[model samples]
Target chain A: MRAIAFKEWLKLRSWLGFMLAAHLVFAAWLYLSIRHQFRFEHAEMIYYQANHIGRIFYDDLRYIPLLTGALIGAAQFLPELLRGRLRLSLHLPMGLAPLVLAHLGIGLEALLVFLALDLAALAITIGSFFPAAFIGSALLTAAPWILAGIAAYFGVALTLLEPRRRYQAANLALSAGVVWLCHRSGQYQAYDLVLGGVAGLVLLLAPASLQAAHRFRNGEP
Target chain B: MTSRLLSWLCLAFLTVVLAAILLPAIYAMAFAPRVAPTHLFYSAVKQDFVYREHRGNHDFTYATASGEHFDRKAFEMSLPFIYYKNMELWGLLPIEIDGQSFDMQAIRDARQVFELKAREVADRHPSVPVHALLDSDPGKAGLSFPEDVFRMKPDRMEFLDVDENRVDPALTDRFTEALAAERFAFPARLVAGKQTILKPFDEGVFLVDAEGAVFHVKRVGDDPVIVRTPIPTDLGIRSIKVQENRQRIYLGLVLTVDNRLFLLQSDGYGLVELPSSGYDADRMDYKLLLNPVHPTAVFGDGGTVTAVALNEDLLPIAAYSRAVPGTTGMIHARISKLLFPVTLSLGTGNSGYLGWTVSGPAPLAFLGNLLAVGVVLLFGRRRRIAPQQMIPQLALAAIAGLYGVLAIALLPGPGPATGATGG
Candidate 1:
């Protein structure tokens, strides 16, 4: 496990660092932009717009986590598949399921760290102007977007590691569908009721890459 | 084995959910329903109910319930008060209707139009609970957005100044004491106000307290005017919509849990219940048209529009309903029912929240499921799969219908092909 972790760290260190830097930059940008709104516009009107008119100040942050997850996914798996390193990794003493899960698990941990930072930045920014109530609703609104990040990470892994072209296309389409479901509504706490279903999809997609790894090992076309 | 099965199940789940969401949308887009807006009114001149239906090709049909047709000019002449401007424009005013004459000025003052949509009743959007109370008596400066917004907490009323973003203790205590004097239950359930500078004046805020008692709160020249209304506490009020009109006859409209309509009459805060028949607030759009003579309440669902006219004493005088053509019987609708066994809804027209509801047209859906099973069997045969290997796919198709078939076809099942047995 340590050897695999070391190898993953060697491959992912630069990407992870770049992602962390980008996330910090995004957090600062979010804080400054919202602060600019408060400084120029009437804070009361802003609150009214957010509460009544369904205006989302943090809408730009919606797709940032998605991109982060996708980039981390490509960084972790594309090289391994291209260099046929995954084939040798499968020959390791570890079980195939654990090996595939370990790869996905590492990428997921990195994505979660970024998502947590994104959420923290959002909470602090909204908290600066609005009350604690606004913070809760803002986080709830971002819940599905956060789920989209997790789904994208698993989806990229599944698509990249799949042996066949058609199955890869299938995985890609399925992943897009799940992401679309996550972003179907832009309202605050819109998906609060159905968030469990989305979380269930993330749980399912986590173990899904194992099947693709098994198919690759069998040399299935 | 469990992991492989879970993976297969995951694929199937994704397939079904996506297909269920997308297929119906594509079907709806292909066979979009068209319904014309029909306006219903009470013809005080004829002492009957009438409707003007806007049909396709710019065709308009004006008629009464007894099949009495009127030309465009005559239709406007029938409801003199409603079309008072048109009547005056065409030199048809001063005509006596039920022994009363209406000038444009009188009609304009008496005219009240209130539209209630299903989405408003659903309250899907999270509105800032803090309300900016416009000074009801803005005297010279007119109605303006106040600096402080007040929130009705469970125990007391809290005021927050927008500029400082801090609670004003003096203002909060003053209003909280006023509400307390009225014996108001501390926790508020519903607070309705028109928070805009667009209206003629402000009616303050109408609140339903913890015990469902109604109270009116407003600011008039730095003094808080609170009135505990005479509305019964057990009224089970579902929603309250406040409209500050020029007439000052009524403050706003109230919808009860049983779908009854009541006017919050300004005279001593009395409740006047209107006669509503076949009105489901959850599924219908409401239009209450108040005139000096006969007041009419029209409720329109997708398929039909029903209107009830009330006499001066607020008694139901006449009722009329018109059927609006819908797409339920259209060819595409029939085809959709035959192709898709179940409908999956994420967001409904009535509510703002996103939820998942799976409703199947059972018995009719069974046919679609059977057809899906047949298609899966053919695909299995083409793949040279053994019968036992096809069991799970066939069963899923039988249950999820077309969605299941799409899922299984899009996602490969776990395990190797059983083609060796066939060979």
Candidate 2:
């Protein structure tokens, strides 16, 4: 467990520099946008203006994690399955669940590290204009981060279980359907819950997990 | 297992927070009470004697008389008929003094004296209608009283008075008989020193002293004219016929007479007349006014008093009225309250564009949901990359967080001048 967690941290560190740069650029753009849109004449007005800026920042921030999860899931898991890497992994002196959990843990850790950096960047940029209540506002602004994290976790688990070209196609189609349903019902808040539940259930019931021990015994590779 | 548990925990927390934010609107919908409705009325009195003195700079006396209730109900019911049918009676009554018509000033003075004597007489009797006679000469037809009286003189000159004491009775009787046959009689009543007759006759008399001061006598029916000095001490007199329905209670020297229209009824406090000036009929609100301009400024509880000033072409140039206080304030308060629920709901949806502008802060909950979707997509995208190649995924996550902060900081505050656009 410790080794796996360490490996995840190493993976996260590789992306730290680029993530920091992107956050800085986005923060500057957001600041300029806010300044152009609002003119604050009093302290109260300034507070209100800050709140608006924060909400916009958070709304766009939520999409990054989910998009990242989908891309990473397709790249890392699908090819391994097509090439029969699962048999090689099963021969290792580790339980299949632990090995899969290790991969998930590393992905989640990298995502969390990136999220933390994003949060720090937001706090610093927003604080310059709203120094008095920066922390409170940032925490309030972080609510989206939690929901995004949950959806990413489910995505990683689903990709590992259904690591085939057809399954990936099916997952993409299903994602579109879920988005459409959410938009039609105007139920954006419940999007993560629905998506997370569906993905997690599919992963838990994956045929790959049940066939892992049998495939290893037969030496199918 | 730990990762799955963490995910479940996060979801549960998000649901609870959303429910908490929606509570205020739910409670308001379920249990908020409605406000009660109210009604109001308004009217005014114009050109009455007290109102005239009040308008002018004169200090006239006032008196009140009480009799058999004066059948106010009958008067009020017949008011419309009287106003439309006999609108001419709305003008000033002509009073002849010493065979000369009295002007506005003299008539005003006579009316004041009549009010005083009436009040004095009513103080004693309190039941009978007091009739105080004015002293005037029957032969002085050429003498003019005052300008206003002259302006109101009858077109026909047949109604004239002649002195019987200065002419032969036989010749005067024939002239008097002819005038009587023509329904013309002496317009002035007789005054023997301080005594005066209140009845109409052919040869009524008046006595004027060296100072031009006059006194009148009282008469009952065709009975011999009573020569009582200073007139009868007490005769019940209530109010002068000014405008229809409005009356001025004699409040000492009437230096200022206000047109008081509606009476406020406080269950335990009896009836308190509301001043026509300060009361706002449209809004049913009241404020204090030092001086009011019109006599007919009175209106009932729910009535409105509008001031209409027209230009030379009779086009309405300016109009003024007061807004009802409580109602106006209440409406503004309600609007302010509505802003809160709408603002909160927007915040919950991560929909920063829901406010007045597309760039404004959206619901925090909405932002959260968006962030959740973004993370899921980001993680999925990076799944095929080497663990060492996760730099771009991390970068995207950072970008999403920063965007969230920017949206919230630009939200507009509540107020009219802020110009926060509606959702």
Candidate 1 chain B lowest-lDDT run of ten: B414-423
Best-matching candidate per DockQ: 1
Model 1 misplaced stretches (Cα beyond 4 Å): A1-3, B37-40, B45-48, B51-64, B67-96, B122-124, B321-324, B417-423
Worst 10 residues of 2 chain A by lDDT: A179-188
lDDT of 2 at B72: 31
For residues A128-207, could you state the per-residue lDDT of candidate 1 as single tens digits? 87766788989999999999998888889988878888789998998888888889897878887789987887667777
Evaluated at residue B176, the lDDT of candidate 2 is: 38
Interface RMSD measured for model 2: 32.6
- Please give, for residues A135-184, the per-residue lDDT of candidate 2 as tens digits: 44454434344444435444444534443444334334333332222222
Can you list each candidate's DockQ? 0.56, 0.01
Candidate 2 residue B136 C-alpha distance from true site, Å: 66
Best by TM-score: 1
